[model samples]
Structure formats: structure tokens, C-alpha cells
Target: MTATDLPAKPYRNTAFDASINNPSAYASTLDDSFAAIDWQASWLCHLNQLGYISKSISQLRGLKNDPAQTEKLEHTPDIIAKVLNTALQKHADALQQSLPQTKPALNNQAQTLKFVSQNELPEGEAYERFIGTTGNIPTRDNLHDLFNGSIWLTFPKTKALLNYYHMLEIKEQGIGASRGRVRDTITVFDENGAILVTAESSIGKALVDFDWQESLVAPRDKWDEPKQLNKQAQAAVYIFGHALLEKLLHPRKALCAHSIVINVTQDFFTLSLSERINHLDQKVADYMDALLSEPDVSPRKLSPLPILGVPHYWAENVQPSFYEDSQVFRSGRRSQS
Candidate 1:
């Protein structure tokens, strides 16, 4: 059977789907994105949210500690509990509104902890000996306590891949049609072997530079002047492109790099049978040929050096309408627009 006839992969995520339906999903997703990319922005956003919670808790704790506020202290936990409960309820309502309605399966068991709910302090008589000098926050454990639960932790690969895809889409076609530039394109595949994301990047310089000097003089009497040579930055653009596809398909496995070429002419791009086969599946090669043959302005297809893995999508497949008119140029049979 042909590749097109291959059976579709099946995925099951009933519990996860329901869990994301809660309002806390937004907070949790943001938290996950921060940890996955190690982007400081995510943590800063959470810190801002936690700051408000910390301030409210501190004020209440102060009132509870004062002897004159003994009556208020007695009511503190209940008030805190009510506030947390309301927040959680609001989260649920928001989730319900945002997500398409779907019946929850009885087997769904994902539980989210409410920050101000009745939580018994982690207790044990042995704590006096084993707890060490590191004390629980001398002040209330506002952010500390909230982060300990499993829900607050990030899912590494899932979040990384998702964020990568989200950023890619935004970079390509702006939020609508006119706002964004298509630079470089990336496609990610699940280990399950299905494509997860397909993205295009706007052409931007990703370059590294270095200079090395060597003596160039006759040895006997005259001192030689040092000469310098500058080399073109080895293109990471193609390496990342090839590696991304290979990793998505083989995942955690390594593959040797291979060279392939596409030639761009004034009107059409051309690829030899061997060059086409080297970079992508035969079907993709055929698709690329059809794409470049269109009447749109041709872009340059640079000479291919050694790059690794199967190409999931060709740069040319991105419709020419997405790029500026002046950028079109041809090399071999490929168009680099």
C-alpha cells in the first residue's frame, strides 16, 4: 500500500481534555510554558498573580495574630476558604465558557487543589528531628504551598512542543492575514509519527562569525605578517530544519546528514530524482514540484550542502502570497522567497 493509504494514528486523552476544561488550565498552561521554555516571562506572570494572593493572605494573617482580632482570627480560615472556593468556581465557569461542550467520562479523575481550602499542615512528631533548620516560610507559605501540588508542575515535552508550535504560527501569518511575515518554517511530529505542527519563519539572519590568523612569512630573516580569513557562518537554518524532522520521526535516535539540492530557474524550480529523494519522502518531492511550477514569482533555491533527515515540508510549499514580491529569487529548481 502507498503512504497515503496508511492508517491514521489513534490518540486517547479523555482525562486530560476534561482537566483542561477548568479555568485553572490557563494558569497551569502558562506555568507549564514557562518551565518548558525556561522563559522568565511565564514565571513573572505567575509571580504577579501570586503577589495579589500573598498580599491578601498577609493582611489576614496579621489580623489573626493580633490579640484584639481574636474574633476575626477564628473566622479567618472560613473566609480564606470561601475566597479560594469562589476563585476555583470562577475558573470552572471560565473553562466551561471557553471550551466546546463535551460530555465528561465517568473515568475522568483529574483533581485540582484549591489554594485556600482546608489543607492539614503536613504533620508528624518526627518533624522536630528530621525537618532541619530550613523553616517553613516564617511568613505564610502563600506561593510555596500552591506550587507543591502536581498540577502546578509542567509537562516537559508536551508544553515545549505546543509552545514551539504556537510561537511559529504567530510568526508566520500574523493573527489575521496581513500582519505577519513568513520567515523559516518548522514542522514537528509526535513520536506517534503524526505531524504535530507546521510553521514558517520570516527570513532573519541566524549567523555566527569567527576569525583565525596564521603567520605567512619566510622563516630565515624576514618576519611574516599575519593574515586573516573569514568564513561564512555555517547555516544552522538548514541543519535545524533537517534535524527537526528527523527528531520528530525517529525521536531520540540519531541520523547521519545527507546532501540534497534544488535548482531554481526564472519560472520554475527543479529537483533531480536523487536530490529529491535524499531530503524528503517521494510524495513530498512531487508536491514541491507542483508548488514551484505555479505562475507566482520564483525565489532562489540555494545549493544544498549536507543536512540531516527527511524534509516534512518544503520551503516552497508556503504560498508565494505570504512573502514580499522583491524577495523572490531562483537557484537550481528551488525558489527561496
Candidate 2:
């Protein structure tokens, strides 16, 4: 059978489900066992090898003991640079050994970056054509880049495929401030979790059929509450950019960032991690092909893609009701002027 025909597989959601009836039963699975020193050493070594000493160091500090530091670092690029450089000095010996030489060659690549899956490198001509540009690749020095790079390492194929489609759409439609098909394919994380809804899917007739606005606007304060947790998990697909895995653990009728929220059983996460990646990579590939092959295809016609973002990332001018507005949740009742 085709990949599309294959059953949905379970994956871990980084957002803890405090509502789970028996937390102890799943507690062991969440443990990463590494101490702070070990975690720092490991990341420093990895980033150094990749020539991202400063970025890795900054991320470790910003994310020192918690993964949620990403939101704080997002707005403080200056602080990130300062802390990262300090980290490089503090861990000089480890960084020196990780590098190929005492000094590495540098280039004039652009500072404004876009992330692509490093795992898919040594790519063919077709891949290059799809990408349309070079040097936009993200570096490890930035928290955003580091988080994105982690996503690539974990979901290489899926990330690569999304990049492929993103570039293709950009080539066809050209870039603009307005949201497009390519932009929808990604999901960014915020303080609460992954943000699933985008500008396009947040309004019009679609809003009424599904509780998309309500699902999207719920705050972190209510996330742990059973009803709200289920609501957020149902509407969301937590692809933790800071971590190595993506979460689509719970099933819901709500729209996901990329496609439908398939029914993935807990047994799915039981498989080896590699097996899980293979399963998801194939599923995404199949979905992309099916999506593109349809007649009269457009971003609006396809499943609402997710581009997850952090809190301040979306907090600027969003309607307060989206998160605080109770009126947006009303169904089947049109206002009488």
C-alpha cells in the first residue's frame, strides 16, 4: 500500500499533559537522564563540530535549565550574541578540539538566514532548483537557527520537503508581506506551545465550522486544565523546534498546521525513534504529492498549514479576543446591527 494508506503513527508531544489519568505510567518516557553539565558538554561539542560555537553556547544559556527560554531569546538578539561569545571563551578547550583547526575559514554569507535540512545536503540538481537560492541556510549561533536546525536533524525529510514546497511557491508567486501557501506549511512554537492557526485560516466561513479561533487563542494559564489542554492539543501539533522531535500525540477533529490531525495511537510512539521518523517522513511525502496533484490546487484549497511561532512573535497586534475575546467562540449566531 502507498504511504498515504499507511496508518497514522503516534508521536510525543513536548507539552506535558497533566490531565493524563496516570502520569506515572508515562513518566519514564519523558526523562532524558543527562545532568546539566552533561547536557552542556554534549551540545557544546555538537555545535562546535558544526562551527556554531557562539550560537550553541547562547542557546544553552538562554535555554540553560529550561526549553522555554526560546521566547526570551527571540526578542534579545543582542544579548544572545554577547552571551554566546562569552560561552565560546568559557568553553574554549572543548570548542577548540571540536573545530577542524585552531581557526576556521569564514565566508561572506548573509546574516539574514533561512533554515534548510542539513541532513538533505549532497542533494541533487532537482533539489538545488527547488531551493532557488543559497546561503540562506540558518546558523547555530542564533537561538531561532539552532531550534530550526534541531528540527531539521530530527525531521530531515519532512523539513526538506517543506523547504522544497516553500521555495517552489516563492518562485511562482514572489515574496510579499502577505501570507502565502509556503508560509502555512511551517509551525512555530510560542510560550504556550505550537501555534497552529495562521491569518488565512483564522477568519471567514471556515471559522464558524470549526472552533479554530478558540483553539488557537487559548492561553498558557489554561493549558494544563483538562478541558483547555485537550482543546489546545486537539487544535495544535507541537513540533518543538528547540527539541529533536515533533509532537502530534493527541487526535482531534481540528485542523493541524500541515494537514488533518490523523488518529495516532499511543503504541505508535513505542517504536524505535528511527522507525517513527521513517514512518512520518513517508506520510508527509505522500501527503505532499497528493496535495499538489489535486485539480485547482491553491494554498487556501489545501489543508491549513501550520507555522508555529513563539508568544511575542504573534503578540504584537493580534486581537485580544483571539486569546481573551470570548465573543469569537460564539457559534451559529450572527450579530444583529
Candidate 3:
């Protein structure tokens, strides 16, 4: 046989494809439990060299707005107001185009960043009820950490828009957490970029639900019956959330789990999965232990499934669990006016 016609070499390794197949592998170190520390560091350095960190902040800044550091508070406030106003206007237009089912009236109030809605608001009153005072405006510090910058609006599919709005609510009012959307969305793309998978936010929220409970790795019993799955992740999986559809996009910056509660036992190490868990578990455990041992402090939750994953085998049994009266957006429904 000609050399050019020869079959490609077979790829073999002890590494499990589940973790590496995830997009989060390119963004964070949480999956390094089995990985050598040097290897993790080197890989992270390479990812950074590819401009992941800088690009993320740059995109986020564009989504929000950074008033260039100015010496005067007077000039800064006006600049900050203009920047935020611009973001609101752009988001408003995107929202108008997202839902074609309902006819929305363009309230003159959007230019001023007030709450307005259409009948098909996928996220409900969460954004409108966000507690921050509109007149207070946002601080320079707040502008720099804009969330949901990397996500794009896809018409007729309102989840992305709602998720982005959720990010805005959290940023504007400090109402909820802000790390999962990017990590989970990016993870999907990194793992199955070749496939055409559409991600719905309810599914992302289901992942966040698992994250909040520290129960991402559901035991096997939960998946045997499809009927038991929750409204979010079940649909996410059904829609092929595992496929990596946008791999060519720039990698996201690493996410860190913030303050969290913990109950570490000397025996807990024995409870871990044999080969599938990320080596970064120890670091996570350490952070949790530190927070739990401290007095007079609240721990912030971190995004799960970034570096490693929810442990695919463990997820085999997980069913989505939706809460009644929750503000989560279910698949289907968007209003364009």
C-alpha cells in the first residue's frame, strides 16, 4: 500500500475521554485530579498563551462597559452611564428580535434602563424585580466584571437571551451567582464542536442546581427511568448538550469556586470515583475545608463541571429536578416585538 494511503495511527492512552471531551478542560484546572500538576500548569499556560484570559475580559468589557479610569467622579459617572446605556440598548434590540410570537411595545423607558416586559418573557419577573436602584447607576468596579459576554443571541431560541439577562440581573443587583453559564456553555462547545447541539438555559440551570447542592454526580439509580428527570437537564441531554458545536472560538478564562460550606471526613477520600474524577478535587476539598473551619463568614459557590465534569458515568442516572415557583426558563417561548 502507498504511504499516503496507509491508515492513520491508532490513538491509545489511559486517559478517559469524558473529561478531555468537555469544553471546560480548556478553561480551568478542576479536572486535574489524575493529571500531573506540571502537565496541568503547562496546559493552562498554553491556553493562556492562546489569549484566553485577555479575550474573555475584553469581550466581557465590551458587553458591559469600562469607563476608562478617570480622575474625576463627575466625568466618570457620565461616561459610566453612557456605557451602560449603550449595553441596555443593544440588549433591548436583541430581545426584540428573539421572540417572534408576541408583539411587544417598545417602551420609551428602555433608553433609561427601566423594567419592561412582553407576554412571553422566558425568565419571568426576575429581571424586573432585580433590587438595584436604576438611578444609583453602576460603579466602575461593577462595569469591569460583566458576565455573559461570550454568549450570542440565536433567534427563536430565547434561552441564551434570558440567560444573558439573568447575568445582567446578578451583575446589576447582586441577586444570584454568575459563573456557571460560561463554564457550562463553553464546556459543551469544547467537547462536541463538530455536532449541531442547541443548548437551552433550563438545562444549564439544572446543572447549576446540581452545582448548588454539591450533587452534580448523581448516583446511578436516578437515570434508569427517564420519567424521573427534571425539566431542565433532561431536555438539555435530549437536545444533545454534550456535543461541542463551537470549538474554534477562543477558550474561556479559568473559573474558581468561591467561598463554600464543607464537611470533610478522613474517610471521604475513599468515597471518590476510582478513575474518573478530576485530581483537582483535593484543591477543592481544601478550599471548602478552609471555608467551613472559618468563623463568621459566608462561602460563595463555584461553577462545577468546568475542568473535569459531573463524571459522565455518575450523570447517567441524573434526572432534571425543577422547582415550583422557580424563575428558571423552560424550553420553548420567546416574544419578539
Q: Candidate 3 overall Cα lDDT vs. reference?
A: 0.25
- Most TM-score-accurate candidate: 2
Q: Estimate the lDDT of model 1.
A: 0.24
Model 1: runs farther than 4 Å from truth?
1-43, 47-52, 65-67, 75-84, 94-143, 149-337
Question: Candidate 2 residues 1-337, lDDT tens each?
Answer: 9863343232222222221222222212111222222322221222222334333343334343454443343222232233333333333334232201111012221121133343334544333232334422423333454444444433444455555555555557665676354444332211112212222322222333444444344442212121122222222233423432122222122213323333344444444433544455456545555565555454443333222211222332145433332342334333211
User: By TM-score, highest first, what's the ranking?
Assistant: 2, 1, 3
User: What's the TM-score of every candidate structure?
Assistant: 0.22, 0.36, 0.22
Q: State model 2's lDDT.
A: 0.34
What does candidate 2 score on TM? 0.36
Tens digits of per-residue lDDT for model 1 on 1-337?
9763343222223433332233122112112211222112111121212343334344444454456645432222233333333333333343342211111122222122233332333543221111111111111223322332111111112212322333334444445433222112112111111110111111111000000000001110111111111122111112213232323232321332222232222111123222322233333334333433344412221222211112212222134332222222212233334
The number of clashing residue pairs in model 1 is 25
Clashes of each: 25, 13, 19
Better by TM-score, candidate 3 or 1: 1
Better of 1 and 3 by lDDT: 3
